[model samples]
Target chain A: MPRWEPDAVGRLQAAAIDLFAEQGFERTTVAEIAERAGLTKRTFFNHFADKREALFGPVSERQRELVVAEIAACAGSVSPVDAVLRGLQAAADVMFEERRAAVARRREIIDANPELREREWGKRAALADAIVEALRARGVDSGTALLAAGVGVLVQQMAMRTWAEAADGRPLREHLSDALLSLHAVIGQRSV
Target chain B: MPRWEPDAVGRLQAAAIDLFAEQGFERTTVAEIAERAGLTKRTFFNHFADKREALFGPVSERQRELVVAEIAACAGSVSPVDAVLRGLQAAADVMFEERRAAVARRREIIDANPELREREWGKRAALADAIVEALRARGVDSGTALLAAGVGVLVQQMAMRTWAEAADGRPLREHLSDALLSLHAVIGQRSV
Candidate 1:
């Protein structure tokens, strides 16, 4: 049995990110992260399965839930792609708009490591799959659902990137709208 | 130094895919794959770095080169997304169209493994990066280039999936065109 620790996950995540950014992710250890967080290795194990999972934390899962819930709330009359965009925009508002600096740091750390990069790709794919399921629940065909999910993923990616990197103070939802318009223009400019 | 073997890469890939599909990818070994190809482990190393790489083989790199070459040859007058579609269509003709069965087998083997799916995502991203570079060289703005590349990747993914699964004898390029049109319609249906 383990004793309770207040805000242990938050402390551990902050400590882990700082250490990973300071000494590089490969060289950092779970023990070091636990020490920095003023917690025990057992507590670390309680929250995350490993060092890699620590890097990602739980925010992604929360965001996925928010997006799926938003999609489910969309009325059947809403277009499939529109529903996905609405879900992304809603999640961005709740999860990402306030975490600009932290999100940027996480992106940098993941970008620097190939294995982390792959894991990030897997996470994005999982989110897309969740979106697809939500869209299918609204009676959209499989093909349209898939393409809409694809576009939604692209919008999230583009919006998150710009929201994190750009010095401008635009909110993430605005970036989502911008990316959707940009994608619309790109697809509409088709040659074939 | 290794002796020259006729179509060594082809034989190794076919053998590896068959064994992986027959006896699961993790259960299969490089030695088993090499034996199935009637080649030594040394020959396998000379061709691919590992069992996973053997699964992907050299076809992806060849396709990338063909796509970049096609993009470079496109006149500046062509629109950015159009140029990307043309490049993808050109590569499909030379690399994928006639090898539908082979491509389907490879996709199945990759899809069965989570790690391989991440790698497949990475490969698609790499192709998108190559497209971005090609478009940048043509003086397209970076944002537009990235979005165009993103759309191109989506088009490739959808086309490859349908071409592999659909029993109808439509060519890969036709699927590419169809996917592009579908994407256009999806994006054009945006609510926001």
Candidate 2:
């Protein structure tokens, strides 16, 4: 029997983050997370398969959806890299800007744990896959699509690394643009 | 005491690849690999830690060393992306160019196996990290260095994917150059 609880997933996620922060991720248990969220173990399982999913669950899929949709919606006039940046920036605005704190903490925890870092890479590969499909839908060639997706992923990672520790509270989208510019300079291309 | 054997590692790798091709990777045994090489299983253990390592062992570390050494030898006037390409080309000439058939077979086997794919990605990450270190030593800024390393990796992956499939017998260095040009075109920059 499922409890008809609104935002059960949200509650569970918040509870898991708090518990993961208080006790190390290795020490945190599903039972403790459930209790912290005022839910049962059944509800926890209903929402997430395991304790690690508690941290990686909600945002990863949704952000991918947002980016893919945005890429699909991009006009054909946009270059592949620009299209990817637009998609990434759109997702940043909708999914990341408000959740910077949680995103940073999640990254920190993942960085500290080798297992979580591996999972993060898997998640990244999936995102790139979706972007490739999205670009293909827009008539982009396979090689260009793959290259653009790889560049987009690199920019996103660099932006996230800076965005997390930035004291000036810059938006992730700007950081993404800046990273792209840095990449251009590194490649000896004129600034965009 | 180990038996004195010349080219034991090379013999083992060739034997392992042949056996892995004849039988599936899952069904192939280290003992069989050693036997195929006309060496004892003891010799196999003396050379490589496991079956997987037999495939990945010798080339990866040596390739990284070649890349790092070449990057260090680049003149100060060389840009990061060019410096990386030179390093990669040097390594490709020394480690990969002459071994196209073996490299292609190894890639085919790795691509078909999930465990090998995971190890492949880990190796790619390590190469990127080594590029980062090499660029840092050249006085490149961290952000640009990271981006350049990432770009180099993407170019390398794209080149490898094509190099394995190309019937034209193109050198991996030319493929790398083409991939980098594709990236610039994708990003709407003038091809270098």
Per-model TM against the reference: 0.94, 0.83
Candidate lDDT scores, in order, read 0.87, 0.85
| Model 1, TM vs. native | 0.94
DockQ of all models, two decimals each: 0.61, 0.33
Give the least accurate 10-residue stretch of model 1 chain A, judged by summed lDDT.
Answer: A183-192
The runs of at least 3 residues in candidate 2 whose Cα sits more than 4 Å from the true structure, single-residue gaps closed, are A1-54, A189-192, B1-16, B19-54, B189-192
Q: Over the stretch A1-192, how does candidate 2's per-residue lDDT look in tens digits? A: 666788999999999989888888899999999999999999999878788888888778998999999988877777778889988999999988998889888777877776566566666777888899999998988988899899888889999988888989889999998888777666664221
> Model 1, stretches more than 4 Å misplaced?
A1-3, B1-4
CAPRI band for model 1: medium
Count of clashing pairs, candidate 1: 0
Predicted model with the maximum lDDT: 1
Task: Tell how far residue A179 is off in model 2, in angstroms.
Answer: 2.1
Highest-scoring model, TM-score: 1
